[model samples]
Target: MDTQQNTALTRALAEVPGPLPARGVIHIVIPHTDRFTVVGNHLAQHPGLSTTAVGFAVRIQSLPQGTEIGVKALAARFPEGEKLIAAALRELEAIGYLQRARTRLPDGRIVTRTVFCNQPSALLRLPKAAPHQPATPQAPAPAPTPRPVPALPFPLQPIPELEPTLQPVQVLTTAPQSVPAPAPKPEPLPPLATTPECAPAPPPQQPAAPRFVPLVPPPTAPKLPPRPLPQPCELTPELHRAATALLADLRRHTPEFTLTEVDIQQLAPAVAAWLEREARPDTIRHVLTNDPPQPLRHPAKLLRHRLTVLLPPPLPGAHDLAVPVRRVTVTPFQTCDGCERAFRSSMPGRCRDCRTDHAQAAA
Candidate 1:
């Protein structure tokens, strides 16, 4: 049938209010069969089945077989509309009330076939199996006899005899004997020899002539002066222009403040530092003017402070001018006279080992 005919049939079946149905009403017949009651009860009691889904199921059942039920048509009939109708259709498909399958046509095109089953048995019934050859019947096994559980043994008896009482035994008491200490032995006095007066006179002869030793001073190392700090680089013309523009913009934003040449020079280094860090002039201007917690009385000072705080550290110089290089004299290694080992020393004659040995020998 054509679209117009189908629409007319649907409208006739619906019996919608208009000029036609004022006195009499048209009705769509829904079968009162066991299958219908089972399906309806199943859908009504289903926890997952929504009201819209139940309505859709009822409408689907009321409609004649082979009637094209599009989502749009079902949505127009149902209060929940298209999304709900689509969901309802999916629910029905999931629970076996409705089923859809894709079939390839002769023209190499695919089409979907949807089947609606009102009766639960139609969808739930199992297929019949193939017939098997008859076999001889076997005798049933004999029933097993239930054995009674054994009774537990009588409660354990208490011991008849009591333990013997412990008795105290008498212990003898004796006085401890004191031991006597040994006496100390007396020390003997050393014998004195007589001195001869003739031998004492020879000892007074010349306490040898006093010898003079030269004093040696300790070696001192030369001290190096501290390094000087590197000077900041000069600002280029581009940097100067950027700084001037930034200041002019800031002045415009804060009309109460004035930027002088001295202020500009003082702040130029900060601006140059920011520029070196790859921050654009516009970005710096935005940061300075966009949000000020309080009124900026000294715009130049604030800008300088911000630039200084945010500025990246300076790059390393190719050649550091502050640190001066000094010539260092290296002593040649000489073999020690005592240990026969090579060692570097400031003194030319002997190594430290040999010198320590000679000093010990003299001592």
Candidate 2:
């Protein structure tokens, strides 16, 4: 049908209650809103399921008294137009119209239904309708006037009692009685005149007693004997000799060597020996990602790694792990130096843990 005739038929059909088959195109538009472009485009895309234009005029014709165009039923109108239906409904929602969709099962029976407000799933505001003066509904009368609201005339009848029971009525009564007045009391005579001479007031209150302060003694920590001073051992003499020799060799040329446990054992066995001498089986402490940054804790092998390793210039030339030497951080994890987290991360340059050493030194 031509757009004008089709629209008229839709308008005519909207005034009455009846079902219309879904043609190849159903254009449901909100009337007075002039949002037909979106619906028209949507309907053009879907050539499978039949559809008819629906607008304010169409809506008025489709809905009967005390009835609404249910979305569930609307969905059922186009059995094969599910995809286009949402687009159609979304157009209606964008124009501030609600939608109801209905479905039929494969066995040719009504099944699922969905009633949705004209809303975007993401919760966008629906466009509001412009000001519209609705047509005044008219009714045929003696002089052609709107039909009056019919009175709901309930016949005058006595109310029936629900069950055999007596309702109690409560009433209040008053009892009047007069109380006797008390007898008047007599006024007492004034005391005889006293002497006019005034004795000097007692001296002002004595000054407040001096406050007594309680003294508190300082807390005394238990005095434990100081740890014995480590004495220079025969091994220490040997260590001094070895250290002096190594220092002398390093002076000749830059030194680079791996100091493994065996190497350390061979050289500075004195410190290890001392540690072994003092080692207690239960004195073990679990180490996490804590690296000893102090030169004193630097093993000979790690120093050698640095000597062999040519780090990327701390300059911003290259990306990735390049960082200011000040920012580079290394922590000890496991028992190896090569192991790192799955994702490469720079170690913190300075550790806050050493702050306690500073505090102790200040004290």
Name the candidate that leads on TM-score.
Answer: 1
TM-scores for candidates 1 onward, in order: 0.26, 0.14
lDDT of 2 by residue, 69-185 (tens): 344555675453555555555554333334344588888998535333222232333344433322322222223222322222442233334222222211122333432233333
Per-residue CA lDDT of model 1 for 11-112, tens digit only, reads 766664545555666655565765443445767777877887777788788787787777887767656678877888887776667767789999999987
Residue 354 of model 2: what lDDT? 44
- Model 2 lDDT, residue 12, Cα: 71
Per lDDT, the best of the predicted structures is 1
Off by over 4 Å in 1: 1-38, 76-80, 119-127, 132-363
Residue 256 displacement in candidate 1 (angstroms): 47
Clashing pairs in 1: none
Give me the overall lDDT of model 2.
0.38
